[model samples]
Target: MQLNQRINAFVELGKLLKDLAENETIAQTILAKAEAENGWFTRENILFSLNNWAEALTQANLLQWMSKYNVELLPQESNEVKKVAIIMAGNIPLVGFHDFLSVLMTGNKVITKLSSNDKTLLPFIAAQLIEIEPRFKDYVAFTEGKLEHFDMVIATGSNNTARYFEYYFGKYPNIIRKNRNSVAILNGTETEAELKLLADDIFVYFGLGCRNVSKLYVPEGYNFEAFFKAMYHWKEIIHNHKYINNYDYNKAVYLMDSFPLLDNEFMLLKEDKGFSSPISVVFFEKYDSEESLKKEVSKHSENIQCIVSKIGIDNEIRFGETQFPKLWDYADGVDTVAFLLDS
Candidate 1:
């Protein structure tokens, strides 16, 4: 299929996903299956992620994203269709959708090794796409066992697993992503509304995705009163047994160790220099100077994903916008579309 045909099929699939949100009966059924497979895949979180994808898949958005590349030449330049193998990370629902979309958008075949945690949602959506345009049947495949016979690869996993990916797939052209966490820089001037929105950046998808802000860089004398008060918006998140269990466990461990912690009966804020915090906690550190903070952040740029700030930091992602990334917001700053097209 041509690029436009592929884009049209996805556009139709987007409509189906958006419509599914309105059809509570169908949406609930899908959510139930996802929850059964993974306890972290709560109905609300799945629906939130689905809605974001639906909104992003518009014709105008797809066309605009494609306009950045010489997409029309894909079919003309290559006689052999490259079979791209994708190892998806299931930290959040449909986490690997972007890679899947990139492969097919470039007129290449995709063979996905689905994560056991997120096995249901993507396949169901892929089925819907095939129904929208049957030509996808020739391009899409999912394997339950070891992957073989692929021309290129795209893999996402923790830093440990990334080493294995590089060791094994190093011979092939690939984009391998490791662990990354987002952080927010608070200058102590944010309004309550902005802080409330920041709550979504921290709590949405239960803070499983890399884009979720797991750390904060606050002014040296910043007070926790306002930040804690604004975090009340996601108090309902504590009601989830899985989340509460982590919160209780982490809180107990910290208390036992006599580590300083700020608790709000739901989330815990700890003074830490780390990027990846425990699920029920957010790590934070105080900064005395903008120059030092910028230098420090730049030093760890490899481990940082999104910098949630409105303080004029270069390439900073605004509050509540990290999770709503557009089609072209490639993870790890690696251009998936360019990678696929070049491969």
Candidate 2:
């Protein structure tokens, strides 16, 4: 298929997702299946993902995003298609959709190994795309076995599994992503509205995505009162059994270890230098100045995915908008489209 045809198919798929997000009956049924398969795929989180993608897949957004690249120069016919094998991560719903979209938009075929925890959603999406354009039926695939006959590979996993991916797919052109977390740089002057939005950044998807803010850099003597109060916006999230279980367990362990912790009944805040915090916990560190903090952030830039702040730092994502990444916001700052086009 041509690039325009591929783009049109995805735009139509986006509209279908928008309609599904609105149709509560269909959405609930899909959510039921998702939840049954993975307890972390809560209805709220899945819908949040769907709504974001729906907004992202507009024709204008696609064309504007594509305009940055010369995708038309890539091969269009099926015979010339480059096969891209994608190993998806299941931490959040549809985490691999962007890579999937990039491969197809570059006129490549995809051989996906679906994460067991996310088995239901992307396949359903692929089925919809195939329905919209019959040609996509040839471009999309899912395999529970060994991947073979692919020109390139894109994989996402933990630092441990990434090593395995490298050992195996190292010879092939690939994009293998490892564990990375988001951090927020906070000044004492943030407005209540912004703090409330930051709650969504931390709590949406239950802090499961790479985009979720798991760490914080706050000015010295930063009072926790306003931050804690703002976090109450997601108090209902505590009702999730799996979340409460984590909170209880982590709180108990920290108490036993005599670690200093700030607790607000649901989430735990610990003064930590670490980037990746456990579920129901957010790590925090005190910074003396933006210059020092920026240096520190740069030192560990490889471990961070998004930096949420309005502190005049470079490439910082605004508060609460970390999850709403645009089509061009490539994960790991690696351009998947460019990789595919060059492949």
Candidate 3:
């Protein structure tokens, strides 16, 4: 398919997603599909993912995102069409959709190995895309078993599984992403509105996404009351059985170890130097200076997915915006489209 044709197909897919988000009858169909496929794919989360994609796939946004790359040059660079295998992560809804889009946009065939935890949504979206542009039917396929018959691979998993991916897919051109988490830098002068927005960064997707704020960098003597108060808006999340179980378990472990914790009866905060925090918990550390904080963040750069702050650090996402990444905001600071076109 031609570049504009592919872009139009996705733009249509985006419109369909918007329709599904607004039209209750259509939304329920997708919700039922997601819920039956994975218990954690609640209706709210599925719709959130759909709505975000709908916003992202507009004609204008697609055009703007594609503007950075020379589309004509992409085909000239690699006229040999290859099949790219995508091993998706199931941490949040539609977590691997970007990779799926990247492969197709680069004029390559895609063989997806969908995560069992997120099986339904992508296939449903794929069906709609095929309906809009039948030619795409030849380009997309999903497999449940071991991946085979692909020229290259893009995989997302924990650090341990990434080692296995490296060992297995080493011969192929690949992008193997390990565990990474986002962090927020707080100067402690944030308004109530901004702090409330920061809560979205922390709690959205039930904190399952790599973009979710798993850690906080705050100046020493920063008050906890404001942060906890803002977070209280999401207090109902504790009623979620799975989340509550995590909260109860992690809290117990912290208490048993006699670790100092700031508890809001829903989430737990502990001082730590780790980037990846457990679900229902956030790690925090005191920073002495902006320069030092930047240094610390730079030290763990590879392990960080995003930095959320109003501070003008390079590539830092604004509060509540980490999860709503623009198309150019490639994961792990690695350009998937560049990889595909050049490979």
Best by lDDT: 2
Model 1 spans with C-alpha error above 4 angstroms: none
lDDT of 3 by residue, 171-222 (tens): 9999999999999999988988889899999999889999999999999899
Per-residue C-alpha lDDT of model 1 across residues 262-331, encoded as one tens digit per residue: 9999999999999999998999999998889999999999999999998788779888898999898989
lDDT of each: 0.92, 0.92, 0.90
lDDT head-to-head 2 vs 3, winner? 2
Error of 1 at 199 (Å): 0.3
Q: Write model 2 residue lDDT over 244-300, tens digit each, in one string.
A: 999999999999999999999999999999999999999999999999899999999
Q: Which sections of candidate 2 miss by over 4 Å?
A: 77-79
Deviation in angstroms for 268 in model 2? 0.4
Candidate 1 vs candidate 3: the lDDT winner is 1
Find the 10 residues in a row with the least total lDDT in model 2.
71-80
